[model samples]
Target chain A: MTEEPFRWLEAIANRRDYVQQQIGTGSPVFAVSLEAGILLLGVGSGQSKVFEIFDRQAMAALGHPADIERVRQMLIDAAHLEAFTRASADVNVRRLVSFGLSPQLKQSFEQIFQAPFMIDLLLGEVAEHPSKDVLVKVNFDGGFKIQHGGVMVAAPKPEQVTLATDWLKANLDQKLKPESAALVLLLAWNSLTSGTPLPEKSEQPVKLPDALVEQLSDKVVEAAVLERKGSNVARYVPLMPLLTG
Target chain B: MNTGIAGDFLGLLAQNNLRPLAAESSTRAPEQTHATTVFAFRFRDGVLVAGDRRATAGNVIVADDVNKIIEIDRHSLLAIAGVPAMAFEMARVMQVSFAYYRRSQLQPLSQEAKVRALARLLRENLPLTLQGVGVVAPVFATVEAQGDKVVPRIYFYDPLGAQFEAVAFAASGSGSGTVRSVLSFQERFGEVKPSTMTLNQAIRFAHNVLTVASEFDAATGGVDPLRTVWPVIKVLDANGVRDVEAAEHLDARKEGV
Candidate 1:
């Protein structure tokens, strides 16, 4: 049997695909899990939804019964990713990188999943280090590529080389805040699924206020609420925008 | 020391048919010379790993100068807070294992790999931990180079061998409760952000926390300025790991800077 981590990722992807097929259109979901915090955004069938990612039961359905407890613990850990983020709020991104799955565990996961588990880390500027932000992408094949002042895509080879690359380059170049990053990713996904021309530039840049962004959708609002509740202190504000209208 | 072994150090140990001392002991005895109070947190430059120099046997203090913080490698630090002997042995095995990996693979083990290796070792010693002969909660950390930037990471482990990657800070041992309370209070109300603390501030904060722990917990030791015996304080970052000297520690306390 495959390892729990591998099984869990596969199960989530499979379930996501099933959801998209059932809705009869592309549901491009983008998720970022940091420490125990999770942010998931989905655009499906002309509607955008923001919600939490996988649950233990959903994962259990795809794997062995005995592995349920272990998988549950792993998911619980993932849920606490935000707490970790909050705790390390003063830390530079370089030190934060060490607080993830070990290389040995990653190897085990890769062996079981038959693909590399990619890590795309976005690091902010540190005073002692260089002034530039960095995006480090570790491929599934155990190799990694570093990008300074560029974009990264994790889709299939064709999409990554074609549509995704074009959209990111044309639309995104400047340093992006969390909300802007989420917006750009969602917009890119919409363009990819709809085969619409990538916007070369915006006449009036999209402006999303923290309060209005919080009221985007129930799913997005819930995500924000959950994050605030989990930390027991309001440290993180999940970017939620009403894109459906 | 065994030679002519292949693969990592752990693999080499298995090849030599060697089992941990805990695995050999069938009769469980409640031996409790446990070390206490160790933690690590990220600072401006890298991560600061600190531990009080105290070990206790039941109700009696056995050693006051026990160095609980062990440097596992150039980039990695391990702070153990349980059975002193077991913790020391675990640190030794980790050092050897890491060296073996580097020697064999011609490259140092990544921070993640070091964390996992230690976790597995602790997991294998769980039986002893359960028997109260080898209970150890450890914080392992390292600094890595990503692009031109250096990142410091910290991980906390349980007696069951479960590894947790602490995002900003982690604490373990007998006085861990007190230490954590102090940390939480600082995070909630402290003027400086815990993650953004400078090296001097982090060292001072750690000292203050350990001093608080020493007040209530007999096993936890406080700073001894007169004796020049302070907590084992070390910092790991882009420059490398280095122990905070006694003189500097004394100066920090005197100046309150």
Candidate 2:
């Protein structure tokens, strides 16, 4: 059986893992100017979930943790407006996302006295008229690019992208199921953390079970701990009941 | 970091050796072309702002298609009179100011705040207005959120930036007297309530007033069907500000005007 049925869950898990990695690193290495960190949009369905990751390091650098919390609260307060279905038909979703973030960024500039920080966003949607599945990358400066039928990464180094793309090409088929897509992303994350060489391609791509995927996610977190703390131990935040239940 | 985006903007301007206009200036330039006859009124949903297309230098008609209505943001509209150039510049700056605030703050300004900001800009331009070289009268209109409902707020400003909030309607420029008279007549005898008038009725009323102003005042240009150069009319409501296109004016044009 293909992993198509579990794609949404996998996408959410992928975002959670990526955010965890960034937080573990204690640096905003993955910060993009795309408003929220990641967004999963069901194209024609108009269903979407936004994963907003607040960068502790970035906020700490700004010397205003309270301000960061305030910004997050503001985002939560305005989350309804940021919903995909709330966007006007004439307006592009990516532009709407930028618009949603503009007020907070403006306020930060006014109150925090810092330059605009980068916001990263990933948008998944199904396009009508043309009838295509699309994933869009959006930046804080209201810039965006569209991607189709592949895993797209934002704010990654050249080497990381090269490795991730290599794994993606080798493993992903034209009709990518959610689990396989998540596995490909996991392999890329594994490569990034392990600094290991890319794996050789086999005739049949390996299938990753949900349990194994979780284990691999844990491994990625462990690697982050080793890199940051010189140990193989790390603490993981439990998934929110709203998300897990 | 900064107390507000406005302060930062001023700081940046000063850093670049630019200064905002003072309440009074020491020097004045020669008289320039000034636009006339812009007005706005509160209606059922929001506010309707209308402006004549004529620009005049004394008695001479300098231009016949000057747009006096400007949308500062999605929710706010500005109708300008007096020095066309200065008014346009003020509108442009106001647009950027609102956008900058929204972009940096990630939220739109309240309607009252927007009107106050425009008034402050006008006050800063007082020096030029005092010299009679850059006089501009602007009527600002916006729809504001209050509790569960939204209401329209309109304000008109003088050369020195004194802002007056209008409960029902406001008018400015050379043809204001004629427009005011028409508005007063409509309020006194017209069967329709000004506040309860539908969007269509409000627009037609503004057009009729402007048409009358054109008959009495050369500075107020009436509708030109052949050229399709109608007055700038905009509506600011729950859906935001949008131009009432010239095509929409076809049905609103007065007969035998």
Candidate 3:
């Protein structure tokens, strides 16, 4: 956010520091603490945890009295407690959502996914066959549309693919600014044409492109996301880049 | 728009003493309530988002062909799973909120920032959360640049203002738990899927998990994918999120990422 760092090192540093700042001094559990959770910002090794939000005042005074002002400021701003209340009372805290969904979530998936215009969405839902559990037909009709923001690099088809992998492989890797890598990935992921199925289930999806494959997870494929009316045999087809991604 | 603000929003509401519900995780809902099935999965480069078309209030199906996937912007997409009316309103507000963020920041918020903002919004909606009427619990999956890797992350939220990172994948709404178990087994973690797998592979994954869940769990609906029109499936890869049609699965062997 500051000066939009161009070089990889500087950009990455900015990103890392910014994320750390955002992490701040909060509960390690990410729970909903009504009171302050002390942040042990010092780097914590596997043995010691770094950065936590503490709720005690007297203890904080005894532990690090020099940070009392900072702690008070945090208590006031984060805990929304009065200076006097934060300092005077010995506090005990509990998490509102230790084992359940956060109270902050309640909207549908559509609203949650589409918050970036500079982003692209690939629509890929296919159902119109029989349950492969009972049927013998491998009828597959896959359709997935791509919608993207203004084009920085257009790849309507494989010929037009400007994906980070494609771009970087097409002798542009050296020229690409790290800032544009995100855009390239966005473009490739939103490709309108079909290419290959994802690599989670098969070994081939991993070999298609180094840049793309490296980023993907090695999670095993479940038969949960797909549908086969009855045929155990699969009828493969090309739908969109998202499917092949 | 990414209701990253949902948490903060709910927290703000709760601070004001309003009741909010974690609709996505509401096990206490009336047995006869509209049920929506939603899920999110990380792809090679992007994230896939999907939902069913049926809304059942009890045994009666009130709506069919309800597309849960919505396009919020060019880069991001949203798939909703919750009370329909409440889901719609939350989606609407979230969309407006993105515009608000853009206006305030004078630039579109980063994808990561969007997630946090949506979390905050949900947190601020806490007042409404306690009264059994809450909205905004949805699984958000996206491919973000974490160093050189474009790692896809799936974040699941709770009405009480908490978040958990879902590894591999996550399913929400009425039939998540049962489906999650089934998916855990069905998910292909070891294979190179991007080039050799088919859309049906993903659908089969969804169908297999849903079928197993629906067969045993009363909450999860049975899978009719490929029966009627299969449920909409999208993939988020480096290419971005796109829908996968049945025909696309035909002869998809030759294509590569």
Compared with the true structure, what per-residue lDDT tens digits does model 3 show for residues A115-224? 21111111111124211111010000111122111112222222342342333234223223222222233223423223442222212112235543343333111101
**lDDT preference between candidates 1 and 3, better one:** 1
Of the two candidates 1 and 2, the one with more favorable DockQ, higher being better, is: 2
Predicted candidate 1 versus true structure: per-residue lDDT over A46-152, tens digit per residue: 22233221111011011122222232233223323322223223433232233432342245344544433332111212121122333333322324444443444
On TM-score, the leading prediction is 2
Give the candidate order by descending TM-score. 2, 1, 3
lDDT of the candidates, in the order given: 0.58, 0.56, 0.40
Per residue, candidate 2 scores C-alpha lDDT tens digits across B1-257 of: 22333423444444444454533454645557889999988778788899989998878999998889987777888899888777877886676556445533446666677888888778777777778787888888888888878888888888888889888888999999998787777776878866778777777777788888999898889765677677888888888887887656766654322
The candidates' interface RMSDs, in order, read: 16.9, 14.1, 17.1
lDDT of 3 by residue, B1-257 (tens): 11234323333334545333234555566644454667776543456666766667666777666767665443455666665555555554455345334422225567877677557656766655665555446776666666777766777777554777787777777777766665565455535342233454555555555566666645445556346565666776655556777665332312421
TM-score for every candidate vs. truth? 0.50, 0.59, 0.42
- Per-residue lDDT value at A20 in model 2: 35
Q: How well is candidate 1 docked (DockQ)?
A: 0.01
lDDT of 2: 0.56
Candidate 2 per-residue C-alpha lDDT over A47-142 given as tens digits, one digit per residue, 9 for 90 to 100: 111222111101111112343334333342233122211321333333434565555554333332244433444444323211233455543333
Error of 2 at B135 (Å): 1.3
